[model samples]
Target: MPDLSPAAFILLQGARVFAPDDLGICDVLLAGGKIIAIDSAIPADIVPDCQLVDLSGRWLCPGFIDQHVHLIGGGGEAGPTTRAPEVVLSRLTRAGITTVVGLLGTDSVTRHPESLLAKTRALNEEGITAWMLTGAYHVPSPTITGSVEKDVALIDRILGVKCAVADHRSAAPEKGQLASMAAQSRVGGLLGGKPGVTVCHMGSSKKGMQPLYDILETSDVPIGKLLPTHVNRSEYLFEQAIEFTRKGGVIDITSGIPEPIPPAQAIDRAVRAGVPLAQLTLSSDGNGSQPKFDEAGNLVGIGVAGFESLLETVVELVNGYRFTLPDALRPLTSSVAEFLGFDNKGAIAPGKDADLLVMTPDLVIDRVYARGRLMVKDGVACVKGTFE
Candidate 1:
């Protein structure tokens, strides 16, 4: 039976736990939104009213984290008529995402960063963990507090700043400018005890991944401090992205990319090229615009990104590409949590948040618990967004 109360005890027994590392048949105990015990005999001592779910054959894993999303939705690329509608909570939970990092995209003027911040808060209030980056594609990021450092350091929900490079739509920030942003983000994160990384949306352009390398060559900022996303969007960019990982920088490869091969194939290529598998992570880029352009640089078609593709990518990594369950899951789980300094998430360990998924052996999501609250049951959302 599912427990609807936030602070009620829930005991799950006889499940194969992939604490993201295959801890075989274990019993998990959750109380007050935290995992109180794992692989223990604590179930024998639970109170009578505790919700007991006997999972003799199901698999338990940490919930997925999507590190890049336009929570308030993104667009205005094709025009005002093309702006995407904001994401609702049920849409995310149904896709197995229990943690998300929201940000603005190319349309900062109409879709403000402050609105993104508020949406991040709404997701939290709706029963999932949420954080956001505090800038858009331009340098000198439009922030709630007038400066990147101030926004990141003072705002509890803000982890760092988001900016774009190597794209025609970007402001074409130089190496010095990027380094400066990274430095400020680092300082802000240090002050706020956050990750403080500058999340750069790598754009499709001739410059490729060179701007990050330029920043590395010219500045004292650490490679880890600069997290570049959309690395696998093009063959040239993917090749350079592999090199970036070799240089010890973490890169986010977007799922649902219009690529010749699946993202997992690219991951396999990276692994063969001696890149540490842990340095590569996955994000949905959900609710952002997928604009098609002609050679004349005009928008020809547009569509909205779906959260299901992120889940599909994980399944492909496991079933199609033959990645182990734990390996396939780490990028969307533990790795994202590690990158964002989310100590309480990404793993099914004692003292960690009880954000988890119950899955069938065939990789179907059966149930989802966010912060110990049962948000999804029987592959359908039992909870919904406020207006949904």
Candidate 2:
């Protein structure tokens, strides 16, 4: 469980704060799990009992928000033994991910919605923010409340639903079915006061975004309601995603895609092609299986995704591609937090949750604070999950 001790004030000095906007050298004050003050210098005499840490020469940025993850484990395409293990707490904090959105993937049969919900709550208790989408690859997808609309409207943890499209594993529902699901998700989001987006898993099928286009052409569902992921899986799909973003829809690029356009390169391409940065986001399909299939449609090899890839991609965007720190920070931080409706996350301004990362000049995470508690200090985890 989260450390529930009486609130302690913390004063950090001499850090270059990003707020993701390069706030220059500043002193930040944290108390009661929130950022209470950020200034050029906070008077130490005001809070005499506060603990002070000298963060000179370190870079401080908001903690990352990974919008797509398999918290309860995903996969089972090969066999029961191939199901990936659940993600532990240290794995996320070490990678600087303070908030995560979990989902069921290809193996919705073996993993139920309740299990996903329980695991989300478990992560929250372990001291991080967590939320989830209700369904998985199958349409008429599995849910805790039996109906998609009811699931989002009633379940506080559920922000939306997910389904597979244009993939061999997907049920390949008709266009009308897709429209109905989108409608239900939209209504559920309206009732629940959340972004009831239908997160679509885009596969490498030749259909290539036609299903989404058909839905927009036939129904009244707005373009913003559908979020397609894995757009970097193939060049053709990536182009289609860029066009979708230009048309005011959001697109999510997965960090683990192999070959062709990698996540960093894809982001660069999107920026150059005039895609609005706000409409683009990146996610780590962490703890889910990354399978390779033979021409005959058999799963020949399987590998699991790691959460660290998310941070690695961001680092590459800055160090390798010459992106400004704030530009590289957008997709993983502020953009995602805004997309998911997390009011208190995504930035380091006052009144935001005290989820901040202290990184070395080279971008290695040196310390991590989530909700005013130090989770990692000097590259080592200070707090670990119950079973970790």
Candidate 3:
């Protein structure tokens, strides 16, 4: 059953509204976890029972969707104690992330796909939508079931497989192995009607995956299936990622690196390079461990990723980098939705989920709504996970 109520509440009067697709000045009618209408004004008769919120001229944009998150801890290179703990619900909600795609990082041995699936379901039960990738960085590829194909087809929340590519820390699959994995994921997606994306983790290493050129040369999967993340971490890597975009692949810029160049600058560089803004997406590798490796490839320093960086990226884009609000918001909002094949997310259209954020011109999140319910109001969360 779809939410067909005639806007139980109408948000009238916003100076600017980013419906995740474009910028406009219009009132949004929200009801029953879905956007019922977007019009100049609602009928007077429908106003009494509905809750009307006056925006006082603020920007309303679609809530953020983080694609490359370590949901249940993604460390272990340092030691057993270095593993990150499971992410808390309030951590994500307060950061304005209404949707997230979790993945396993280095320690797939200790943390199994079963644990990842359980954690995802738990988050979903708490009102935040959660999904996970099939495997970690290893070649054998750990799965809840023995096979990656089974995991993608049988597990409703499992979308695709993620591997470490072009990094010293990577399993570094040969060209043939990478193609076989992509074939398995593509066939599974076709069978289950799920996104068969092969999410790749690009690192700072200069020895890139020229091997993947084989899959690009011949494969039924569109280049978009290869979701290469963290492409903006290094200067050369960012250029490689831009070239990938030219080939129709979606590149994810991570917001968690503890480096000299910030995420906003990376985004600006991509824009100035003439990369399609729609082909780029941003994610806060939030709640994960950001390890700084010494020349010996050992962790010497570490920084924790902030859930708040998601919105902070928007602030830096608009304030520091001089990007228009619409330009800054598009990648984090609509671009992510399109990359992950989520039809109802990342938009404020009539039939889309009413997941939105209200913020001042200064980029402070004033309120948030997911599935058409008010979760945050006046910088505080009204709804929280049961675990919280």
RMSD values for the candidates in order, in angstroms, are: 2.0, 1.2, 3.0
The window of 10 residues in a row where model 1 has the poorest summed lDDT is 1-10
Estimate, for each residue in 1-388, the C-alpha lDDT of model 2 and write its tens digit: 5473425899999999998889999999999899999999998866869888999999999998998999999888899988999999989999998899999999988898999999999988888889999999988878898889999999989999899999999998898888888788889999999888889999989899988997798788889889999999999999999989888999999997856789999999999999877888999999999989987889999989998888788899998899988888889888888788888999998999999999988999999988888888999988899898
Instruction: Choose 2 or 3, whichever is better by lDDT.
Output: 2
TM-scores, each model vs. reference: 0.96, 0.98, 0.93
Question: Candidate 1 or 3, higher lDDT?
Answer: 1
Candidate 3 colliding pairs: 33-371
**Residue 291 alpha-carbon offset, candidate 3, angstroms:** 0.8
| lDDT of the structure predicted as candidate 1 | 0.87
- What is the per-residue lDDT of model 1 for residues 39-64, given as tens digits with 9 covering 90 to 100? 74555566767888887789999999
- lDDT per residue as tens, model 3, 237-283: 77777787777777788888635557788888888888888888998
**lDDT on C-alpha atoms for all candidate structures:** 0.87, 0.90, 0.78
Off by over 4 Å in 1: 1-7, 40-42
- Winner by TM-score between candidate 3 and candidate 2: 2
- lDDT value for candidate 2? 0.90
Q: Output the better candidate (1/3) by TM-score.
A: 1
Which TM-score value belongs to model 3? 0.93
lDDT comparing candidate 3 with the true structure: 0.78
Leading candidate by lDDT: 2
